[model samples]
Target: MNSFSELCSLLNQVSSADYKKILLKEYLDSSTDSDILWALYLLSGRKLRRSFDITGLWEILPKLAGLPEWLIDESYQISSDKAETISLILPVDPDEKRITLSEMIKFADDISELPDSAELEKIINILKSINAEDKLLFLKLITGAFRSGINKKDIAAALSEKYSITIISAFHFLSAADPYEDNPDNLLKYYKRNKKIFSSYPFCSAQNQDTASVFQGDCKQWLAEWKWDGLRVQVIYRKGELLIWSKSGELVTEKFPELFRLSQFLDDGTVIEGEIIAFSKGRPLHFSILQKRLSLKTVPVSLTDDFPAALIAFDILEFNGNDIRSMPLTERRKILASVTEKSADQEIMYLSPLLEFKSWKALAEIKNSAAENNCKGIVLKKKDSAYSGNDWLSLNLEPYIFNAVLLYAQRSLNSEMYSEFTFGAWHNDELITFTKTSGGLNEVDLIEISDFIKANTIEKFGPVRTVKPELVFEIHFEGISESKRHKSGITLRNPRIHRWHKDKKPHEAGYLSNLLELLNAGK
Candidate 1:
């Protein structure tokens, strides 16, 4: 546990990707197989079920530390992390023994089996026996909030370097096999033996079209398709079973039962990649409609009838139990068209139609009119390029931008130092909060904004501070709609900060009337 805590601290401090990979490799080399497996699992953004109530901890920690609850609450407001707050306030013991990561995990598992009184006693004893750093990690683990700077890509790269395997293979291994159940000593062997039907390949991503060099060449070398505004998924059928895997590697076969018709149509050992759009009356609906189905574990008949789902099959990755990723996209598209035509479920699965364009100018004009067809934009794929890397490029429509004044600042849940800002627009001479966004700010900008927020705070409401509405910012979003739930009577989709308007006055920001006008115009 001490070593694992140190590793997390070191990972948090480093900025260089290569150095982080080195640290990860070193940790893997030094730790036991069980410890390494759990560490990788946690670092890869997986967590055990949180067994204890966090609110209960907030109440109990004050009693154990002999400190006022208000002090702990205030410290939590500053840190924005419960683990850090409790670790800092609790009294530390000088004579504490080191614990292993597995032991700590086992303690967490044992919490559910013990009685409430026994659990509280165990927690108090463990807290008293561990150092502050270990205590922080243990608290985070039991609460299922153990997050670090490390990502799956970094871990895959470290494994690739250590095992002399390809990064893609390592990624597939990491995504497919459960580290808790699989033997770390036989990681490669198990990855090779695992059924391919249960695993999803690394999704092929797209670069922004403006930055890609493919456009500089002949337009004839590329194929254009409408970039659907829906969820990207990989449909897999193997061993007489069908599965739908999201881009994030979640098994979502049950989420869209309407797509289960593919099992009768698609051949065994075939994998098709496409977008799952909410279709109604033969047209794709907005992503907001499709999002309703994403969280449903059991889809009701009424919901399916209202927002029916369809797959716009665009590419074929595997055919007849063979990996065809290395094949040219032009060849794969031919195979894809043939496969989809034979499926017979044309309403549920349709081939994404290719856009015909003679020149880049014509293509640009078509891209500008993407929203008219309810598409995000256009995607360009090199006809001769393989399906492995980022041979595709996406040209998305420009986001709607609005200038608004910052109204409130609260500590961000994702980080300890940064704060999420709420911005408001003038509505009938009153500042009304419209949206809150935490993205699109660098570390330097975050620090500057944090300092500004501290100096301009007018009132405190627990973790949130009402700030003087003086600073203005440009906010960017995809769409807007009317809503009765908000005081502003409007909602913006996927809003994020675009830039801080240092020279603009609060009065110069946009008004609620303008947003309503834009929303009505869209309708």
Candidate 2:
């Protein structure tokens, strides 16, 4: 292994993107070509193939550090980071040998192929030559868990600054091919070869606006579309290949095979942004249902029958291999309508309908019907605004009842008083708090719920008892707003328990996105 402890130290010291970029660029300028390639893969969020698993790491750590297994286990429980736990338990090396990034990756690959009898001695020898900090990085790389604060965009920024190219171009270059095998010189060559092709573009987000302020705007210059509850995605079809990118730039094509098959109908070199919704009998289902359909390589026949997938395209970024982001939204919408009607299957792909309104008063009445129509709110986009930089606004119709899971319960300060239940929704696997209320349940209901909570308690933090997420309750809130204090990033206003939804599962609980839509609309 070549000396590469400096890189780990740099990563530990900086948190800002700018500083991280500077350090990366500096290292790339001085490091070997192989080291630069490995750095590019790690900084750009590429997961390298793991040669070993952490299951053996526990057994290996004790022998390497001459420490008891219990000591390492206790440290891991406190830190909750496997890399950090191993690093903390290992002895520090004063005369550590410097290992290059490529050499380290190669060594990990070599270790994975070693027999179980020989692997422990080999791992210990490698650890003995490196300090704790570099050992953590090495272990992380071997385990394919090398996530730092930096992301692909940060690496792109550094590349763009160093090479004097656009950040978007850098993104395209990095995404076009594997960095481990693709040389830096290929960035320009790849860019020139596919300069006309459209890559994923950053989503133009909306600013929150009050209900009255949004309606008072010029109705003639604004275009209204229903804000469907689904995953926002960008679908690009270039040179007979289709790709689906989520809002966060994640490649989610394999997750929705049905959507990928439908995207095959799009014209080559076309890019459209839309929502991937789960629909049944031609009506969109809740976001919870859509969540179940995600992260899947193939949908089962039984599940697909219950929740079919569909795409609702609303905006066009490119047409016929030409960039049209600079075009006025109204004109682009016309072209989009024409193309969708010509090439897309009406049953699978939908062009979002535009609503015509004479005034704010007229629109207000229509928005009130959102709940009945399965619409969360209405998106107001300026007709004359360009697609890339235009500031869109969302107007939420009303706050609807949402199903949340019971997270933790706490009794009121007065012992004779009622118990307050902390309610939260599931964000992926995490249960995040949105509201706490004690007003909805009666004396009998409180006693029943309190007894259930006590029986299912997992842990206690002061006065609060953290219970298992087995109970589902329907909650109603007047409005939603951004709150830094909450884990969900938003809080509900005037939240109260509507009723207990005993039939619902924890995974079916409402998401933070449920409140974010209304909070985003009102902002």
Candidate 3:
């Protein structure tokens, strides 16, 4: 591959977007015209990012020739205004063949014997000629900071399609696994060798079900659990050694080592998926326990003691060295239950307790009592069904997406959305008045409401002022409840993010039926 293509391939593997842009410019401006192929593919959406990051590309090139860490560091720190001169200059030795770090490192020892001033000037010009994106890609490659516009998966898919390979095969290629290893006769296999893992990073998912049937089908035989406001954990342990992963697919083992201890609670070898909640006594604890342990490099004795965590396992992905993810919900739960029972310590592996309901009314009862039960919300799993896709989002959170009328909204003084709102929170205790809004909107509705809030400000409720709750906001419901703490008689349960309503009037706010339907659907 030409230098630009090779560089693009490397850059495609990187995750950060900002860094990629920087390197892209550098390479494009200073790189040799012969290496223009890499520059061409930078916009192809067909390459992996590893070729650009100094760290990832280091394996390919001679270490000595790879851009110096100190150089990138010096260029990296310069102010944007000064970066032009200090960091990205014209390339040097522009006509020199693109060489791997391994090759360059070997050549480094012979630098004294090579051409001096002319060769040096050429390389500098090549560096300068590399376009901004290419330069950023180069800098990030050398400095290991290639951030690109797209993600690894997206790049993988695009490249897979371009090269006529399966997405999984593309993943294998990006990940450095030889998906085509068995097919040596195949020409593609040659290039496919030593492929990288496309990604271990979690991806954004669409959890919505287009034709979601809430009112129909079975509401009975449904189960409920308090959706704790903590991190979702997927624990994997083969033979003793355990690892905890977050929903975003990040390795959080270093973050919460105490959770690894819970592996001892299980009887045999197994992999379990559950939410890790703060626990006190035999019950789940508050989400606030996470604050102390989030980003710490070293585990503190006090923090570990302060926010002790527990796993409320729901599904069993792997057991006894077998992957059971494709198993039906009924089967998965059965295994999960069995694993918990077999566990030496019952507390380490407790079956997530469920509240069964026969109808929508039963589901509503459970949802209302969620706060009392210390649950953020309830998860409605269709019994005997298998887990699939974003079905989780539809089953768990959709019922709460009610068309609640905007009770009152005002322009927020916050960042993006220029409107602040006070709606409802449904807690069994006392549905308190919970509000959400933004003030950064420069739109027609925000412009109008921004004026209205200023004119109608009543009293300041700390950061939020009590405005005449006049405008209607169509906030989607995530869950509901009656909280004793709220000013609104009852609150909208764990409300989800949705769009603002500019057309609807305040008087048309949602009704009790709006919430009832959701409760029944959820149940």
**Candidate 3: regions farther than 4 A off:** 1-218, 239-241, 265-269, 342-346, 389-523
lDDT of each: 0.81, 0.75, 0.50
Please tell me which predicted candidate would have the highest TM-score against the true structure.
1
Please rank every candidate by lDDT, starting with the best.
1, 2, 3
Clashing pairs in 2: 2-98, 2-99, 2-100, 3-98, 3-99, 208-523, 209-522, 209-523
Instruction: Write down the lDDT that model 2 would get.
Output: 0.75
- Looking at model 2, residue 179 earns an lDDT score of 46
Please write out the lDDT profile of model 3 over residues 1-523, one tens digit for every residue: 3345354655666545555545454554555432333333234333322322133322222232356656545554674422232324324445434453223222322332446544343333444444444444444433334334555455445545555555544433443332213331242364455222111223322243322354356665444555665678667664454566577544566567666666666544466777777666665654545634654536787776765676788777666766566677778888888777755364455678776677776666666666554466566665655555333533233334433333345433334333556564334532335545343244776666667766777776544556665555556544554435545434554444365556665445555544555444533
Q: What is the full ranking by TM-score, best candidate first?
A: 1, 2, 3
Write candidate 2's Cα lDDT for 489-519 as tens digits.
Answer: 8766568888877678888888877778877
Cα lDDT for residue 300, candidate 1? 92
Assess candidate 3 and give its lDDT.
0.50
Which residue pairs collide in model 1, if any?
none
| Global fold similarity of model 3 (TM-score) | 0.44
Q: Candidate 1 on 429-492: residue-level lDDT in tens?
A: 9988999888788888888888888888899997799998999999999877677778887788
Badly placed stretches (over 4 Å) of model 2 are 1-5, 54-57, 60-95, 164-180, 198-224, 230-234, 240-258, 287-309, 322-334, 342-348, 354-363, 379-395, 398-523
Give the Cα RMSD of candidate 1: 7.4
| lDDT minimum window of 10 residues, candidate 3 | 196-205
Give residue 46's error in model 2 in angstroms. Answer: 3.6
